[model samples]
Target chain A: MDFSSVFLNAALAAVSPANLLFCFLGTIVGIVIGALPGFTSTMGVALFIPFTYSMHPATGLIFLVSIYCSSTYGGSISAILINTPGTPSAVITTIDGYEMTKNGEGGRALAMAVFSSLVGGIVSALALLLIAPPLARLVLLFGPVEIFYLALFGLSVIVGFSKGSLIKGLISGVAGLLLATVGVDGISGVYRYTFDNVSLFEGIPIVPMVIGLFSTCQVFVLGEQKRTTIVHDIATFSDSSVPRMSDIKAHWFNMLRSSVIGTIVGIIPAAGMSIACAIAYNEAKRVSKHPEKFGNGSVEGVIASEAANNGVTGGSLVPLLTLGVPGNTVSAIFLGGLLIHGLRPGLQLFTKYADVSYTLLVGLFIANVMMFVVGLFAAKQVVKVTKASTDLLAPIIMLLCVVGSYAIRNNLFDVGVMLVFGIVGYLMKRWGYSTPSMILGLILGPMAEGEFRRALMLSRGNWSYFCSRPVSIILLVLIVITLVGPALRNRRIMSK
Target chain B: MTKYLDEYLPIAFLYALSAYFWWDVEDFTADSLMYPRALVGVLLVLTTLLLVFTLMKKMRLPQSKDENSPFKFCVVLAASIVYVFAVPFLGFAVSSLLYAPATALLLGYKRKGMVFFVSILTVVLIYIGFRTVLKVPLPTVTLLGMTL
Candidate 1:
């Protein structure tokens, strides 16, 4: 591969006017979505995807890249200002950020958060640039069985994400795979789950399911939560809102270490921003000299959470671009975007679509820098999203879902599918099933099925072919460990 | 309004769905049926496991215990269904103009003035974005000689 030319082309694409403007717009919107209590970064990307259908492929992707990176920063502003974390990843930031606001050091805390987010994002972006191309090169070596088990390995980790019961999560995941099998089978002309509907010939549209699960489900859940204001008091940004040199000097190690931790956690599929921040926060508390002050206006605490969450921004994209495995919900949406633009993830992406890939990578770093600048100036205004009325918000979200789904193929059936999935998603959440598992299943199921069938055909229906390959064997081992690891841990705890 | 999908109801639903899915694939060829049958079979076994876990009551499968008014959810859901139907007939602009406020009302928004204003604005913006900017072939129905 001509690495120099790829980097040069990417540099040009990233600086293109369309990429810059969309990147700016995506960052602002991402921030607002993150700052709102009910809205999320995944929802931001999913909802905005419709609006970006007309955009240039590189422009649209870079736009989403900005949104994915900046939304993590957006959550911390609300966490510091209103004591309510806008996103789950920002929950840890609230402990010290809120206390800092109470002590009139909100400015210092906010400054540190923005700085840490910037640092974390930059580090992970570097990781993505260096690691993704090599990973993609390795994926070129995979055969059908290896690819199939790799997806299974990805899906197996959802058990780790299970809130309560692993069986329930697997059930959700398997159901998603079933749903993905709807529409015409790609390899064969057979229609599996379409139920004789012409509208479903292409299968359930990804955009509709995305809008349903991430946007409409949130609308339904928030609709039931009743309208509530996130900002009560402490509703202003500090005048200076600038980090002190002393504080920066003190917490550089925490920021750097948390960034690395977040990046690594993020690269592991399904270990999302929330876990990254949680791990980083726990580690910060463990190593702090005055550990007791950790939750009480500790700058290290805010730095740890914000840095780790932002670190996930770049790291999540790595697997999505290189391996076609979404590290989290937002990256899942990103995969949908790339596919829509006719850019498949994996080997050919880094080679054939190097310009777009590099643009997204560089644009991500730019979004983080932009997030820091925007966070400095507009953090207070961003927190005002919590004040938006749910009455108005819910209907608007439904409207977006409908229009967004329809805009994909200009079909109304996608709109209907979105609504159905939304209601079903609401039910699933209320019933305590994990939605992410189901979503992952839906996204990965078809690929797994295709690979499984192809491998069988290659081996003339011999099942041993899967185990014969070393890579597939390794993946099978990974699946077993992913499934049984938690159970063994639970047993150990019980024995203790 | 089915408030809670109790253990038996969920199990029954899964059993019926899996049965239908299995029956549904009987017409397909052996190769075509492989994936679908495998999925349905898995679904059936999982549902059976769920039933066992539910009966045991110790494995503790999830139980829906939403306190939110199921009646309200039904109303909003019904409204959404109608709204989706309306779009093909009324077109994006008109249907959204009607659906947004109705949903707000169903979901307990009493501020009719603000709701209506926001609803109209949202509709107009969505129309421009989808029908105009994005150039989606949104329906321009003139049914009953009423242009929308």
Candidate 2:
């Protein structure tokens, strides 16, 4: 409850050289993993968690936080240079960034990403410092009913992300919900779908499932295509003119607005950088005078998406540190790291472990600085990797995917799951289903179920409790609109 | 591959699957029965509806259809099944190395040497990284002293 000691401790811990070194290591590794296509910041953090188990809790947390921040920026490097995104978060970045590269402005785009990421990250860090405590205090008012509704609100996002036919997305989502039901039924202490496997008792491991779905699946799909290497001939920083001060001045407002939008979206549980970037891009386009220029190398689009995605790094940390709830996969692994060190998150973290929290915040700031420098210096080399032939890249990515999945608890079953999902994912792709919605469902299904069950239990089976609360009602309405509004609009247009 | 999944053959297959699972899980109680059974039931119903829709469209206007490559699909499906079965027994390194080259050749890889080299490297790197860095204690059946 005392604030003075916590702040003092945090400030001291943050300034420590050892913590700084760990932060540096995390940032470097995060950047490398994020720069490589088929690997994500989430996967990087998960793979890196085992290595941090032996360290002090503060050091371990700092390392993880640094990785979380840096890897987000790293994703844009690939998206900008190559048409392929290093992570899902960078998907929006590819639209304008790749176009910029095609227009022979690769170096400037890379520079813009680095600078905007730093600005966005720093802004979010400041917001985290200013807003987290007060917001956390407000969150403390939440009962099981509120938490349940919040979880539902998070899970309902799957409908929003569904592409093509909503039916297929619904099927995929239900499949994920079914998968989440496997292992022990938490409330009843009964096994639901374990089928007698000992490993199923603990449930499908999050790390492996995530790695399998995203990485392993990617490998199998890529392997199916004949390997064709692409060699890019983009100009380097020296060859390509550095972005002018006028350019930075012109885009400063766009960067700020996108960062704010991105951070807010990131704070919403389960809304990852992909959505943040997309939302930011849409908002920027909506407000821009020359919206038509967006997909054709618009600097506004690049600024909006790049800043927004990076801003997610700090915004995501708010829930994790405050509620012991992860907003996304990377934060989930970081939460695991904290638990391994015998540190209980939530209110205690802010008060008792304030020093550690401050240290993490400082580490994030340091990581962003490092990301900017590294991205600027190594933009040329990063671009060259994009040009590498698909044949060579595909096999290498396949190897990384296997290793990444295996690294998560060393389970061969997870590897198999990954391959199986990969094939399924490929088929789904060919069949016109959205992989993003499926992933969202897989991530949020269990949370939604647990909350729904708990809310029902607390309310003694009162179904109206969800609508009684203003926030929950609003979220429910939004979910409905997101799901049905699109369909109605499309139908109206078709009828005309 | 070009044919929509909403068709007669796939619909019939789903019906068969639903029936088989329904039988396979006859002994389980209501709690156990609810989730997967509901899922399978939905699959059957949806596929059946899709099939009906396709049939209705066909009735409206019959047209010539291209010959579907069911054989190629069966081959790929069979290969996947074999790959999963082979992985554990042959070891990840061995099975994956073979799997990549075999798949490449099947997908029509002309550069044999490049494919072979890439496959070998893929297996070696995965083995080293997983074993050394992540410390995955994968089984190595070195009866012939082929150390990985």
Candidate 3:
């Protein structure tokens, strides 16, 4: 419980030579992945996870965290240069960033993006360091009933926030929960749906599924597009591209405010970076002195979008580390990484694994600083990655997907699973069903089922036991609100 | 009618899947069957809701676009399936070298020389990273006399 000693140990581990090298490598790789069109940050993290299998837990986490931070920042490079968002989080950046590029001020837009991302990432990282440990302590108060309801609450919120039809999202989520029951039952030691396959004994392999859903599915999408290059003529960055001191001073308040907005949004489960940036951009526009100049080459617009998305990097991890609930898709994959190393989330992360947890926290802060340094010096070079042919990139990414899935347990069956899921993911994406909802369901389904059964057993099958605990009641109310609030809002809009 | 088929067909598929799951869990012990049955029930209900909503024309799902090139997507997907199945037989490196450029050409990339170069480079780099550096034991080809 001594904060000083814990932080000191974490500091020592984070700065170790090996961890530092991993952080730098992760930052560089994250930038490349983020700058390339059709390559998302989620896919980047999922693709590189198997590489971290050989590393120490703390070092491996730091590497992945570094990727999570820089990739969010790296998306703006393509947004500024070619008007194509390298990641979904950067979609809003294209509004004003491309305008600046057309006006021969691409360098200025890039500079503002880098600086705003630095501010947002640093702020969120600090928030994660300050908020997670104390919040994790609350896990001690949760019983099986409370945990069960909490898992349900997470799924409800995801369904509410899903992009398309609510019914489709619910179906996708429920189907994922059903799929999670395939392995041997935890309590009864009886197989549910394995059907004599030995690989199904331990449940579906998460890493391969993740790689297939996020990475290989993307390969198919890119192949179908038939685009040779992301952008025919990418604007060149010049020395004068750097923002002036006056511009930074003028936009400092906007950067800080948007960063705070982004961080808060990030803390809310399933409120992803795209939403965060959209909200921040709107807030920035509302507060700007010259509202007429908002969309057409407004530096504040670029700053707001970049800062907020980067801010989401740290904010999204708080719930994952503290409560075993992922805040977004990338953090969901981080949960997979944590579990892969025999580490569980919640109070144990703070008590028994304090050293590794704190190291990861401190390492995130360093990664943000590293991202700023890399974004400044390497932005020009990394922009060229956007020019790489999708034709060539597809096969290469497919190869990585094959290797990543197979390397996890050295099983060829896992590779097959990856292919099957890859096709399934493509079909899901082509349809309106949400992939993230299904993934969240897969991650939380077992916990929900196990905890629900245990709580019922403890209560001797009394359904009223769920209502006995204050935390369980609160979670149930939250779930109802989450499910109903969106529907009510839609009704209001339609009525108008 | 065809416009709504996207929603209706998926619902039909879900109903069938749920029925299978419901029947499959019949042999499970009461304790083991409880959760799966509950989930199957939930799925059936959700699928029915989706079908009703689609029929009512109340759902606002995005219209499906016909712009995507199905031929290109199918070719790439089929090639990938073959590549995965061939890995254990032909070895990872040889299969990749053959698969990458061929797939690229199939996808309409014109520069054959660059495609070959990138493909070879990809195989060598993966070999070094996975096999040599990480010691992942990637599949190796057994020739007539030796394992390469």
Candidate 4:
């Protein structure tokens, strides 16, 4: 493979007029969605996926990549303006960002956030371009037993990192696997749990289920809020919103360090952006000359939070593109998008589908550039989204959810599936069951099952065959570590 | 008792669900049964552990902040259910026209004009985007033998 030529071609295709237009449109939509309270990047990507169905595969992916990058940055707008983190990943930003707004340095805070996000996004984008191809080549060495163990490793990691009880997280994951078994058995060619329903024969649809879980579930949540608008008083942007060169020079090292931390966390499956930002914020405070200013409107605090969260955008895709594993919930949806377009992740993505894969990778860099440009000039306008009445937006979002679900198959049955899952997701969220863990289980269930069965068949039903392979044994060890390491850490914390 | 119900009832239901699936897998061929049976077995064990933890009071109960209105949630949920059922009969456009404002009002939005405007604008944009641009062939109404 001629690497230089491939890069050149991909850069050309990404910059084509149609691709650029999709990129810009995706950025604008991402900004609006991220600026609005309760409209998360996960929901934003899920809701807009149907619109991309008619697009060329490369173009559709480019649009989605653009949204993924910009939306992570967009949350900062509201976090600074309203003291409400528009996305969960922005929660740390609210500490200093809102304080800055109170101190009437909201414009300066916004400027720092935009610059830091741009730096973070570009750094992670570079990491994706450099790291994924080599990783894809390495993953090609995996066989059925190794792949099965890898899937288990991913599930174990998610369960270990789940926010609540380990038992509940495991239950949620197992239940998701059970639900994934509802259709015909792929290997055995026999119906397992269809119960004579034709819709069940194809199994549950991923797109509709995701729309319900992330999008419609949010609608029901928003319905419970009594406030008309998200925040009563909106902070006005001052003339100092433009980025000052002096501040950028001062915070360059902090932005770079936080972005690197975010990228590393993102590459680890299920260690989401919120965790990345929290760690980065702590690190920044520890090393800062003025640690006292951290919770009291420090630009360094705002930069650390914003940069790290945006840095997660590109890092999350590295695993998804190379190993067919989603690093987080939003990337899990991206996996669904790839499957919908008949593109598989892994070696084939680099070999057979190289054009599309490279286009998406290159397009991510362009998207980050566009996000910076948009964040610079239009952030004040985007903050207006916080004032838009949730009362009005809730029903409108519900309408989009219905149409988005139905558009996938043009089947009303899919919409019903979405509604059912919406209700189920709401109840699951209200309780403490891990929704992301369940979602990961749902996505990885079939892969795990198929590989498990295939490995057994190849071994002629000898279960010991899994232990014969080095990679498989390594994966098993990793899974054990993933499960036990967290408990040990907690125990140590308690003893301390 | 109520707090215990919140913790215990869901685990009990999960146990029952797992048991039914475990029993049901007996109807499958050996190959098909192996995977689901293993999964169900795992689920049964996990749910039992959850139940035991709750009984021992070892698990941290999820904190519930009851600040929001349950009445509004019910209204929206009911409205959504009706709207979905109405889509096939009333068509997507007509159903949405009625569903949007009615839902907003039912949820206690005071501004009637903005609700109507938002509702109408949403329907129009969805029509343009889904129908005209994307070619989705959204469900349409039939009036006097012609589909609208």
Q: RMSD of each candidate?
A: 2.5, 6.0, 2.0, 1.9
Q: What fraction of the genuine interface contacts, i.e. the true contacts, does candidate 1 reproduce?
A: 0.46
> What proportion of the true contacts does each candidate reproduce?
0.46, 0.09, 0.63, 0.64
- Runs with alpha carbons beyond 4 Å of true place in candidate 4: A490-496, B1-4, B25-27, B145-148
True-contact fraction in model 2 equals 0.09
Across residues A233-320, which tens digit of lDDT does each residue of candidate 4 receive? Answer: 7887565898899999998999999999999989987789999999999999999999999999999999999989988989988888
Candidate 1, residue A223: CA error in Å? 2.1
In candidate 4, which residue pairs get closer than 3 Å at backbone N, Cα or C atoms, i.e. clash? Answer: none
Which CAPRI category fits model 2?
A: incorrect
* Interface root-mean-square deviation (Å) of every model: 2.4, 6.0, 1.7, 1.6
Candidate 1 vs candidate 2: the lDDT winner is 1
Q: Give the per-residue lDDT of model 1 (tens digit) for B61-147.
A: 455333455555666677778888988988877888888898888778778898899888877877776667667756557867876
User: Which parts of model 3 have CA positions greater than 4 angstroms off?
Assistant: A237-239, B1-5, B60-66, B144-148
Give the lDDT of residue B20 in candidate 4: 80
**How does candidate 3 score on lDDT?**
0.87
lDDT of the candidates, in the order given: 0.81, 0.66, 0.87, 0.86
Which clashing pairs does model 2 show? A9-A355, A10-A355, A217-A422, A227-A391, A228-A390, A229-A389, A229-A390, A230-A387, A230-A389
Question: lDDT per residue, candidate 3, A266-337, as tens digits?
Answer: 999878999899999999999999777777988899999999999999999999899887788888888878
What are the per-residue Cα lDDT tens digits for candidate 1 across A24-119? 888898888888875678778888887777777888888887887788888898899888888888999999998888877888888999999999
lDDT of 2 by residue, A1-56 (tens): 47666666776776688777777778777776677666678667755664564466
